[model samples]
Target: MHISDQEILAMMAIPQQREEAFKLLVDKFSQRLYWHLRKMVVIHEDADDLLQNTFVKIWNNLDKFRGDSSLFTWLYRIATNEALNHLNKKRTELLNSFDDLENVMSGRLDEDPLFSGDEIQKRLQKAILSLPDKQRLVFNMKYFDNLKYEEMADILNTSVGALKASYFHAVKKIEALIDNELF
Candidate 1:
């Protein structure tokens, strides 16, 4: 969203005074951040948890947030770390197919409502979740999030070239997976 680091710094300057900036921050980038976490964890409840944790960490450590990167980048980095940690802690995995997910997601979707998709989304998500962690992260950030490689590089703490390569490999993997099933 291009919120400057200075703006974030100003908001983060006082721990007690950070509440005033809530609307500004939420107005700026909640949905994108939520989905960014969702694409990692694949459940509405988990996404919500991770999103809350990401913001909480940001709020708590905003003063520690260096302005060397853009505010969005900093938020993204936090989001990524929080999501990854949650996944690691839960050691939880998404169900492998439609039947289980459909039943489980019925109630969950009603509660949190991340996305509404028919068949295409299910297949797309299956393809995405099938990817290895780094590839999935690279693909989600580059493809779905439409983030620039340089910015993603900073958020992922990887070189831009490597992020580009990872994205390329991810696309190839998804294409091959889809093709093998359909074509």
Candidate 2:
């Protein structure tokens, strides 16, 4: 069953109803957020950590939430930021070379039992990994999650035109990578 945004907002407004409201929110959005993080981080454990962090942030900040954007978009913005921050931290700590970084992420993907994709999907994932962070985010949100450009723009705080260009470049780069067997 779907809860209306108005219902959620009403529930959140009362001190007594806040916990249940947040619980409903978590139940509704957690899996979507998890997959989004997993696609970017390529490791289930790391995704779990990022998901927890995202929820904690949400819980702490819900009272400050304005109704300017849909709750889904607001939640997505938080999740996206948490994932990006985690990735940036890992990159700084683990950097040796670009190829080395690719190998590490590829190894994680290969080791993930949760990943059931065949050869081509794996190759596509590797190609995706080779993209810059923003481009990879744009590609995943557009291609995998099927988010609308306006929705993505609200979450990414980027213009729709910029997101379109990013996705286009990301697709072209992935095609080239696949053709050359770079991943």
Candidate 3:
């Protein structure tokens, strides 16, 4: 069945239809969600885990969805939170320093078989890793995903102005880092 978000919501209300509707929802969004998480986490395994966690959260909490935002927005918000939380836990477990966090992520990116980008792309990824987690999130959403500031603000629960500032700073930092490495 060609299921829209509204149709899914309607199906979710009926007990028997809920599972089928949720399955369709997963089929529809799993790829987009996977790529978004992949960009944030870099490692395929970590991204897969986070994507599963995001879907599990969605399945468990689907009833609580109030339609305050688009279903896609809600899903992205959940996925973003999962990625950030996973990174935070990893950061705390590995090292007490942000510099260490950068090295860890960069190292993972290097070792990832899926990362087939050229040298400049790899360096840009490393530069992105150097940003604070929040700024990195903003940069990924804005630059890689090409999401608008207003949409990002909704996902990140920040003002558009704040997201813009974060994006601006992230761009500047990434540019400087890449330039320094080149010279």
Candidate 1 vs. true structure, TM-score: 0.80
Candidate 3: lDDT of 53? 94
Off by over 4 Å in 3: 96-99
What is candidate 1's lDDT per residue for 57-82, written digit by digit as tens? Answer: 87677667657888888888888888
Model 2 CA deviation exceeding 4 Å by range: 96-100
Q: Candidate 2 local accuracy as lDDT? A: 0.91
For all candidates in order, the CA lDDT equals 0.75, 0.91, 0.91
Each prediction's TM-score against the native?
Answer: 0.80, 0.94, 0.95
1-183 per-residue lDDT for model 2 (tens digits):
798877988999999999999999998999999999998899899999999999999999999998999999999899999988987888887776664666789888888898899989999998899998889999999999999999999999989999999999999999998998854
Estimate the TM-score for candidate 3.
0.95
Worst 10 residues of 1 by lDDT: 97-106
lDDT of 1 at 22: 59
